[model samples]
Target: MAGPLLDIEGLNVDFLTDQGWVTVVRDVSLSVAPGETVGLVGESGSGKTITSLSVMRLVPDPPGRITGGSIRFDGRDLLTLPERAMRQVRGNDIAMVFQESMTSLNPAFTIGDQIAEAVRHHLGLGRRAAVDRAVEVLDLVGIPAPRDRVDHYPHEFSGGMRQRAAIAMALACEPRLLIADEPTTALDVTVQAQVLELLRSLQQRLGMAMLFITHNLGVVADVCDRVSVMYAGQVVEVADVVDLFEAPAHPYTEGLLRSMPQLGVRGEPLATIPGNPPLPWAMPEGCRFHPRCPYATDACRSGAPALTERGGGHFSRCLRLAEIELTGAV
Candidate 1:
């Protein structure tokens, strides 16, 4: 395997509460090679977003803290880096497109100004050159009439356009790694397809690695080279997209695949997992997903299973992985 662009090992993020420190992410580990797109998928509150935030070192400080593990980007361990050095690496070497463009974008600033700010800060371009580059990136992201729309505020653009603009800002510096946290959550199917396609095209053109976070299996199938299924802050499975879709080793992953609406099965009820995901403060002691997992056994309920390789580079954290087959139960 090629050297990873981003490598995470035994990563554990915690939140300090009145009671004590609660671990939200538990021993999660994964890596992304240069130009490779990795998908982190799970239901809401599954710690997918927090994992990405930890990598960017943007976790809320009052309560949140990275208690253990190392996040290495390129060759440096980011956890030990100073705030000043981390800032320099953030937008220049690794950029992120947040889940909600509305919350991330500045309401007071024009779209052009926002994009130009990133360009100027990272590339040190003069104002005029930054604006020009901003327009170029906007055009590249498929924004029509970039020159006119550049002057419009975030509110002036439609939801889809705002998302594209947000993506444009992320790509403005041509960073080596791009972390997109649910980038297509608010868009319609048509617009979502366009945005996903644009991301794929840009990735190929720029040869940049991507950490694509989403709950949509369809989106993962369309863009991700590898898929990591997360549950209650732990990575239950990781595999190439083809291997994962064809023969998912983890019950949680099989459940998610079965839950996706299929074209030929219109009248059938959508499949669902048995229980809700555990809260950060109250995660289960053993396998976090065992309560909802149909194939779970006594061992699954008593002790958490470490992620181990099954076959074809697929790794699963289920104790019954060797006994279970992919029968597709949501």
Candidate 2:
């Protein structure tokens, strides 16, 4: 409720490829207030993962780099911070739950040892204290028989359990800002629901701000306070969860919404966005989504449209948003 815990402006991340330096994230901006949950939604290759990595400063620099923009956390410029300072900030101030839990956890180390190692190294707690903290977090994350299971190896736990253990490790430092990138990927429906609920509960209890990067609109509807829709590395739309769902302003967002399986259209063919997402090396001239936009016009194929405010803090990046909004979701 105070100020933005994380403020990103004009963020540009580029990757050196065979073609040249290709921008994966282009002039992207976002923010997370204290204890607020903001969802970053996009299909794969839309640069969601890289954007999150940029914040954590985990983008492999030789291949990928933050070419432009500022990532400010708690009023400090993370881009300007030294490696040692950034290392201190990574686990302590900003923690990330990578896309998959299985590969992120070490098969050799027991779950307790991994979580305790973070606490021990970051919080400087003693071995005994770190282990206690690990047990406590495991219990907090709803892991059954935490005292015993905490010592189990990653492979020893079930898929859902391993995911829970991963979340427990991320929360071990009790970081102020938690970045979860597709945390529920490949999870069964029941387990996904449970994991999401646990995350919500833990965030509330700890009063932490969360930047949730996911492709699930249903999940976004359930948990996110605000939603940012990304397309071709740029944020196309941003609004409250209800606003974005009920009255999507950007065509890309509408296409995404229309693609969701609706109860009324149970047996019918599901709606899908036309055309493939633009490749980073061969990006379209104007709006990146224009190629797939059913409502695209001459203007859309020319100069790029700027992100414009659309009443009550809602924003959209489209050349003809007014007309498209009147026509409604595709």
- Scored by TM-score, the top model is 2
- In model 1, which runs have C-alpha deviations exceeding 4 angstroms? 328-330
Q: How many clashing residue pairs, candidate 1?
A: 0
Measured on C-alpha atoms, candidate 1 has an lDDT of: 0.91
TM-score for all predictions? 0.97, 0.97
Worst 10 residues of 1 by lDDT: 321-330
lDDT of candidate model 2 versus the reference: 0.91
Q: Supply the TM-score for candidate 1.
A: 0.97
Candidate 1, residue 272: the lDDT equals 86
